[model samples]
Target: MTIRIGWIGCGRHATWMLMPQLARSGFEIVAVCDRDEAAAHAAARQFGATEVYGDYAEMIASARIDAVGMAVGPEVHYRATLAAIARGLPVFMEKPPGATAAQAEELMRASEAAKVPVTVGFMKRYSTGNRMAKRILDGDAFGPVLGIHGSYMTAPTYFAGEVDYTGFYLHHCVHYMDLIPWFAGAEFADVQLRKSVPGPGRMLLHMNFACENGVIGNVIMGTVQSRGTPMEFVQVMGDQNRVEVENVINLAWHRNPPFKAEDPQATLDPGCDTLVWTPNFTAAANEDHKGYHALLLDVAAALEGRASPAPVIRDGWLAMRRLERMIALIEG
Candidate 1:
């Protein structure tokens, strides 16, 4: 059976990424809805959606959609998702499920009560590099995990618009915040955040977290980085090995004795290398190109009743709790 999907918030994100992949993924784009009628109509025209609505409620009430993809902003996510769940629709929501912890929890309870599956767009967890990282961690190839360090830096063009620095932690960092626990196979016990000095069009955040496995996580995020900087990089260190995912595309792993000597003449082996690694770019053509296909695969499994979605309702709640702590620290 084909999955009839309806999309709410047909903005640039939907147009540029999700919409283009829907057809090929065995999903039928049955309806499009947006607050802006022109945007909705344009999306409908481009995707051959059978219907368009300026109001999501009207679209949800009329369409025979099996699943709904919500691309609305953070402020509207709670209401939109609650509405969809009340109508018994499975939902795929954009990241940072809500603007506050209470809202995310409420949605979790509602989805549970309604027996609807809800997936947060924490797509990084579905990436090939992340999968391999998980495998290595689980297999103890990394030995007993020590700690993790990650950085997410993007140029101003990616900021979309002006942003309040404190809010950026909740809006953006939640993605990595959510994944840290997953990657470590642990839970976050506490979190503290520090912000950069007051500035215009620039922001930086430092996050310190205590994990369940007795490991510490230090995450650095900045919106004031050089334009040429890579988008995202993650380094996970363990007792015996370490893995680095750079720019969300390339992954490199090192086992034992982390650094290699620079000069060949100075090294005992002469032609020896310090880091033994391999690069894989198997899925570089797809939208976002990192774990886009894996996300679709998980969605398909969930739709087929073969498996449950990752970063499900519970994951969203957990992530929100972490965000709440960060917000409290920022507010204080």
Candidate 2:
């Protein structure tokens, strides 16, 4: 069944990254909305939506749609989601589901009370290398996870004025709040932060945390790097084994390989040797290693009332709550 969707937020990300993936199959965007009328009409023309509106509420109320999808500001996400849930519609929205954890909690409770599903975009879980690492961790050969470390950095493009870190906290740092917990397979039980502000807009943070399952790790995030370079890496450690994902595309799995320094007949052992993987960019296939396509596939399934592994509002709430805690620590 083709799910008719009322799409909102026709920004660069929506037009370039998300809508193209959503348009692939099993969904028809019947209505488009953005506060910018020009962007709304432009997205409508590009994505084959018949109606365009500057007001999301008007679009949702009048459009003949089965679901809603949006990549908008946090406050709009909260309000628009509530409107959709009130009409018993399924939804998929970008991360930082609301401006605050309390608002996210409200949206979560409302979705539950109305018996609706509201999926959140935490596509880092679906990244190709990260997914591969998760598979290895779940395998019998890999022992219990001991620790995790991640570094995700970007430029201060999120900052517009007076060195405030609100945009950086919401738009950039929030991803790891969900990602680290997901990798640890447990909620965070304790958090401590160390911060450095080398300049007006540049801020660097090292957050140390312990999970409920006894996994401890540090995550490094900042608005102090160039976006042109690789800005992300994740490392998960186990007993004599480790998995590393570099820049979301390259992966290496290290096993307990025997030393071969004195032996001339050393061979690459499948059981103990390290395994690595990198994407074949020369291939003609349109692969989305950054994970929007894969994330939307699950989202579309959920929108059609089928079972999917898409992250939902509760995940958003948890991530937001953790983000708030981190921000409070930073402020203090």
Candidate 3:
């Protein structure tokens, strides 16, 4: 089923990274809205949306759309998502669903009360290597996950203008808030954080957490790296086995392999060996390494009333709750 969607952002992220993939995922851009009239009109022209508006509410009120999608600010995401829910429309929004955990909780209640699905853009879960690692973890060979470690970094661009870490926490750090718990298949039970600020706009943190399912993990996040290089890594440990994803594209799964260097007949064993995979960038195929396309496919499925694994508002609320806890730890 084609979901007629009114998209509420025309920024570079929406136009370049997101909207172009909507058609492939069975979503038709029926309307586009942005505060910038030119950007809205440009997105409409580029994505074949017939209607355009500078006001999100005006577009939601007038557009003949079946759903709503947006990549705007946290405050706007909260307000626009609420507006769309009031109209009984399903929604898709970029992460940090609201500026605060309380707002996210309110949105969660609103979604449940309205009986509408709200998908949040926690795309890291759908990255190719991470997805493969998840499949391996769920398989019979890999036992229950015991722990996870993650390192995600970015430059100080989020704090370029000022020393505010708000944007850094919301946009950069929030992805791991959703991802690590997801990998552990539990909610966080306790958290302890240590922070370091080397200079203005450059901060680092090490967050250690225990999950409700008895899984423990540590994540390192900061605005201290160069964006031109790879900025993410994850490792999930199981019993005598582990899986690692490097930069979201390369994967390695190490099973309980015996050392065979002494044997002349030694050979690679399928039963216990290190399995590795990397994408073929040279292939003449369209692929989204960042996972946006896969994420939207799930969103489209949910909008069609089909079963999907799309991250919902509940996930957003949980991530926000965890984020707030981490922030409190830093402040207190």
Off by over 4 Å in 2: none
Better of 1 and 3 by lDDT: 3
Query: Could you list the CA RMSD of all candidates, in the order they appear?
Result: 3.8, 1.0, 0.9
Would you list the clashing residue pairs of candidate 3?
none
Candidate 1 regions with alpha-carbon error over 4 angstroms: 155-163, 257-288
lDDT of 1 by residue, 78-151 (tens): 78888888888888887778877888899899988888888887878877667666776778345777788888
Arranged by lDDT, best first: 3, 2, 1
- The sequence of per-residue lDDT tens digits that candidate 3 reaches over residues 264-295 is 98999987889999999999999998899999
TM-score of 2: 0.98
Inter-residue clash pairs, candidate 1: 260-274
Q: Cα lDDT of all candidates, in order?
A: 0.76, 0.92, 0.93
RMSD of candidate 3 to true structure, Å = 0.9
Query: What is the C-alpha local distance difference test score of candidate 1?
Result: 0.76
Q: Give residue 63's error in model 1 in angstroms.
A: 0.9
- Candidate 3, run of 10 with poorest lDDT: 156-165
**Model 3 TM-score?**
0.98
Best lDDT goes to which candidate?
Answer: 3
